[model samples]
Target chain A: MNMSLKNTLKMAIKSILSNKMRTFLTMLGIIIGVFSVIVMVSMGQGATASVTQSIEGMGSNLLNITLTDRTIRFSNDNLSELSMLEGVHMLSPNINWVAPVKYGLNNEAGTSVVGVNENYMVINGYTMMTGRLINPLDIENRNKVVLLGSEVSESLFGQFNPIGESISLSGIKYTVVGVLEENENTLFGDNNNMVLVPYTTGMRQFRTNSIASITIQGTDAASIDKTQSKIETYLMTLYGTDTYRIFNQEQLLSTLNEITGVLTLLLGGIAGISLLVGGIGIMNIMLVTVSERTREIGVRKAIGARRSNILFQFLIESSVISGIGGIIGIMLGILVNRIISTAFEIPISASMQVILIAFLFSLFIGVFFGMYPANKASKLKPVDALRYE
Target chain B: MILLDKVTKTYIMGEIELTVLKGISIDVREGDFFSIIGPSGSGKSTLMNILGCLDVPTSGEYYLDGQEISTYSENDLAKIRNEKIGFIFQKFNLLPKLDAFENVELPLIYRGIKSKRRKEETEIALDSVGLYDRMHHKPNELSGGQQQRVAIARALVGNPSVLLADEPTGNLDTKSGNEVLDILESLNRKGRTIIVITHDFEVADRSKTEITLRDGIIVNRKVK
Candidate 1:
């Protein structure tokens, strides 16, 4: 360290020590700003991680096609057409219902009903826990056989095994063929509270050909984009642009990630404003310090010290103030982030680039704001300075 | 050695010119213990500032040793001050943040002296002022007399050709003030050319030569 810098650092530390309250107050703005950025970014990153994990759990490389309007009908013919696509590995058309099932009195009343095909279990990676899944023969004969999810089985059968047991849906009796295992990674909603019936049985009972959504599994990761493109082209060519909607799960995930990134930056940018305020605080305090030390400036000048020396002394003082504050703020921010992460089940990470940028920016703030005050102190006429009371 | 020929300095208040030092001339040889005694507003301070290179005369010639310094730029004047002269102030203007050793080492620092050499020279200078033991004490921690001694030590550290003191004991008790004057006399006796500015006749009596000023002009000179 240069001599003047050593002295200036000593003086700056002393100045801060002498006025503890003021120093802390000056540091408060920076602390809050840094703390806000760390917490916001950590929460945002955790939320995005949860989303990605949920997407991966829902069967990898999956696509969803929903036919919402009556005019956008995709019947057996359309399903065959989609199945013909080379990249599409499987196409499972689904029909859904919400039939309230009951076993005992008021305590056992519940509604858990789902209507889907036998292929949905295989394509969506679901397996039967008891009896076999509904076969193509059951759908062709329109037999009233059903499969119950684990929770639905327990709700309607009261602890007994529900396989081969009969349950009433819309006052019509159907025999339960199997129970599905509980899904542990349900993010959107409770996937295990659902029940599935053969597609023909659902259409025969509900009397509607309205399909809820289509699940398509691609042959491989590379073929997903091609499969999606082919589906979009087929749907648009067959039913026009406004008829159906196609959503790629990967695209949805990336868009969500983009939103999280924007949120992190916006939070960080808003937090950056307080650093600017802290810089202004340093400037104001330095101005006061220069005035208070005018006599010292004169004494040094009168005793063979040059103008540059006086300027350097004051500059170092202000720079050290802000620089120390910046370091302390960074440390405090990380500490608070860790505490929050522990409480909220999230990980908080700060890049080395961010630390370096914050440190250098604070240094620049010191030099930029300190220049005016240091120059003012240096330019004072020695005689006038000495004459100051 | 110092020489001044027809030096004039003026201050402008709005439009009217206020001349402080009107056509003054004087000379002093090396190793002289000289005093300039004057009443308030008698221009002694202005002349001291000019001699110390803190101010330039509005008109005149000034030569220190053999070099003309009256027309030097501010930067050049500062360089000359750093290389050839040291100043002691009436208030014993020690920097409050610094201890005695650091204050004394300041002049050498400006001269770009290495820290090891500056420390050695500072120690010797403070020792000469009888303040080596108190070298780590800040100005506020020391007595007025000790602060003035540290100021003198600071002046001596650079080994300058001239030591200029302006009312060096202006803010002390007589006992402390006398102690400072005694130190200044001893420094002069050891061959550091010293000049003191004071209005007190008793303080002026300590010098070997005294010049009295009144209303911007030298009125009398006594060789003691």
Candidate 2:
């Protein structure tokens, strides 16, 4: 008989609604399957995004050089020679130490102190919010002038301008010459929490003649590789050992991307196993539904329902179950992602493509798993089915 | 019109061969009301099933309106059942999930009738069976007689050439049974062919013609 698809869908929905608990129980598996996949992929995407942002925060055409051998120090003449190297656009020698600072009644314990030259602000992508940055005179004369990060200034002098104010650091008095801008896209926490001083003053106070690290920007994006290899060869010859590591922004970003990509796929694969289980659950429930509705099948057949009609009816029913489950799962996945991102303070990126793929997979699972039961229903003999209690 | 020529049905259980109908022949004309009466295991149900196109005989030449349906494929027989035969079961097999209107509309839906025409035909069929007032009531909410009437409406809604009822009043009270028999008689009078299968003589007596079956053969045939 020529049964309309609309009528079959109506019948399927009616039957599904008639058994609410069974339908819900069957849908639970699919819901969980879709939920886990979305959540895992979203979190993975978030991690990848965070890593990319951090790598990009280091400056696009910048390279980092950390000296593992403390004995090898870059002298002022050596720094000038390296600065004039081909493909090197700008260079900043830096040192780091931790010391306590006190301004009036506000005291910061173990505050990070960074020693840098005039090129520090340019290479590190820092902008001035209020005062000028440290000049070359500050480094040349070993002047005891310091620049406070935005956060350090806020903590030391709330609502009051701290420029030109004198603060004691490690029992030595220093004047605050400037306050750096508050960078919102800082990779590792707030860069606004540290103090910046001249490398000469930091070297004398910390009792160190060795430079801690060097940051350099290439003349252009294409020149970064040449500059990086030149510096690596120079440092290797000077130290006579491979005691330093050089990393560029592109290398770090690509490595992070690869790691996150593999992690995302692994997580999605684990969740896919649950989806398979969910498909099996649907098949199990569909088989039971067919068996339970055998008499109804017989009645429909006797009323002139063709085998195709019965097959389509059952197939639509299972698809509706999974389709609804997929929708709910998508919503639940978004909600769970929001909750997790908020709780952990991580940025989650749940793309539209992921949601669409998850939904389509659920539908496919429904059709794939539903085939056997629908075929079984269609192959039933009217007489035997009618006789089935 | 229905014609059966030397129709035989057999069932093989392990090493035993059980023949239910041994070359039984029967002819039912248009606008005729007939009853087939038999005791249990007399092959009357088997014959009803074959006539309703619910089963194919082991060997036979069964014709409905000059079509050789005994040799038709399963799908073809299903189409014939959909277009030419309407069935009423003894237990009032109205889908419990559907109301009376939907139950009656089932056959029309299978026929791919549009909703507007299907609703109109369903209403007319329910009105004819006197269940129009209870058309919105589900099977469980209706009395046994009302459910049977709804089943009859479902059978009549398709406008089939033959109405084959298998003990239509078997599960009803005497008053309800008589009401169903009266409806069948009235439908027959309206130029609709009706066949009732029952072992009860009282039920058989309501029909204009009666055939009694014994051991897979017709023992008696009477026309009143």
Candidate 2 residue-wise lDDT, A60-131, digit = tens: 688878877766777777687778888889888877889999997899998989889999998888888787
- The candidate scoring highest on TM-score is 1
Interface RMSD of each: 3.4, 1.0
For residues A334-363, could you state the per-residue lDDT of candidate 1 as single tens digits? 787778778876666666666677667777
Native-referenced Cα lDDT, model 2: 0.89
- List TM-score per model, in order: 0.75, 0.74
Off by over 4 Å in 2: A59-252
Best by lDDT: 2
TM-score of model 1 vs. true structure:
0.75
DockQ for candidate 2: 0.57
Sequence-dependent TM-score of model 2: 0.74
lDDT of 1 by residue, B103-186 (tens): 888878767777788889999999998999999998999999999999998888888898899999999899999999999888
